[model samples]
Target: MPTPILVIDKLHIGYGHKVVIRDLSLEIREGEFVALLGASGSGKSSVLRTLAGFHSVMSGRIVLEGRDIT
Candidate 1:
């Protein structure tokens, strides 16, 4: 596929030793709108925090505009 607007590869996010998000990979295309939906405390905000770098990404790659973000 053509390059995505955002690409997340094998992401692992956590706080301290407590893993919140792991083994997650996704791609968002331009003009696409994606939402994080889940139960409360199920890491929806945690995922957002991970992307915004507020939370720790234990492992993974985040690509934006063909640049690696993490």
Candidate 2:
């Protein structure tokens, strides 16, 4: 949407050797007001963790403010 300020492609997240979330992708436009809404265990916080680099991405790319986080 109108160009993205942030992007996630094929993101895979896991704890240790176990993969909990996989193949996630998202795009956030500049000034976009967004919410990570879902039921419990929907990987909403997992995505945020991956973006913040707290959780290592098994395979994927994360771009934020023109910088690649992964």
Candidate 3:
């Protein structure tokens, strides 16, 4: 198997004291396509925002191409 280009490990995201996402882990390999599907206010945007450096995770790590980005 190829190494993943993006890795989100044990991610915990939230706003202030309210936790919106918890223990979310994901991996995206090269040439692979993925999407986030969920209902409204289901933390989908939060995950994307977190990955784009718009939001900070409460815990865990975000690794990109063998480097820790979070």
Candidate 4:
């Protein structure tokens, strides 16, 4: 198997004390196309925003190219 170019492992994200996402994990390899699918307020955007560094993670790690970016 190819090494993943992007990886989100056990991610926890929230606003204040309100937890929006908990224990989210995903992996994307090179040349792989992915999508986030969910209803509104289901933490889909939260995942993307968190991956993009737009929010603070309460716990866990966000790895990119084998480096922990969280």
Candidate 5:
């Protein structure tokens, strides 16, 4: 299999002192379709926003195309 185009490893996202998402890891390869499904206030948007560089992650790594973006 080809290398993943995007990789999120041990991602930890939170607001202030409260963590919204913890240890979130994912890998998306070329031509792969991904989706985030969850209830309201489930940190779905937080994850997307972080991926879009909208928010800062508390701790973790965000890699894209073999480069670390976080």
Candidate 6:
């Protein structure tokens, strides 16, 4: 099997005093297409923002290409 290009491991992301996503995890393999599907206020964008390093994490790790980026 091939390795994942992006791995979100037990990510806990949120803003001040309000948690948007907790312990969220997923893996994206190389050349794979994925999407975040949810209703409004479901923290879908929050997860993407956290992966992009826009938000702060309360705990857990974000790994990318076998490296701990978080």
Clashes (backbone N, CA, C under 3 Å), per candidate, total 0, 0, 0, 0, 0, 0
Instruction: Summarize candidate 1's per-residue lDDT along 43-65 as a digit string, tens digits.
Output: 88978876787766889988889
- Order of all candidates by lDDT, from best down to worst? 5, 3, 4, 6, 2, 1
Displacement of residue 60 (Cα, Å) in model 2 is 0.5
For candidate 1, give the lDDT: 0.84
Write candidate 3's Cα lDDT for 1-70 as tens digits: 9999999999999999999999999999999989899999999999999989999999999999999999
Q: Each prediction's Cα lDDT score? A: 0.84, 0.84, 0.96, 0.89, 0.97, 0.85
- Candidate 4, 1-70: lDDT as tens digits: 9999998888889999999988988899999989888888999988878888888899989889989989
Q: For model 2, what is the alpha-carbon lDDT of residue 2?
A: 75
Report the C-alpha lDDT of model 2 over 1-70, residue by residue, as the tens digit: 3778998888888888888787988888987799888889888888888777787888989998788989
Q: Which pairs in model 5 have colliding backbones?
A: none
lDDT of 6 by residue, 29-63 (tens): 98899989999999998887878888768888888
Which segments of candidate 1 are over 4 A away from where they belong?
A: none
Comparing 3 with 6 on lDDT, the higher-scoring candidate is 3
Task: Report the error of model 3 at residue 13, Å.
Answer: 0.3
TM-score of 4: 0.92
Candidate 2 accuracy as lDDT: 0.84
TM-score computed on alpha carbons, candidate 2: 0.83
Model 1, position 58, has a per-residue lDDT of 88
What stretches of model 3 exceed 4 Å from their correct place? none
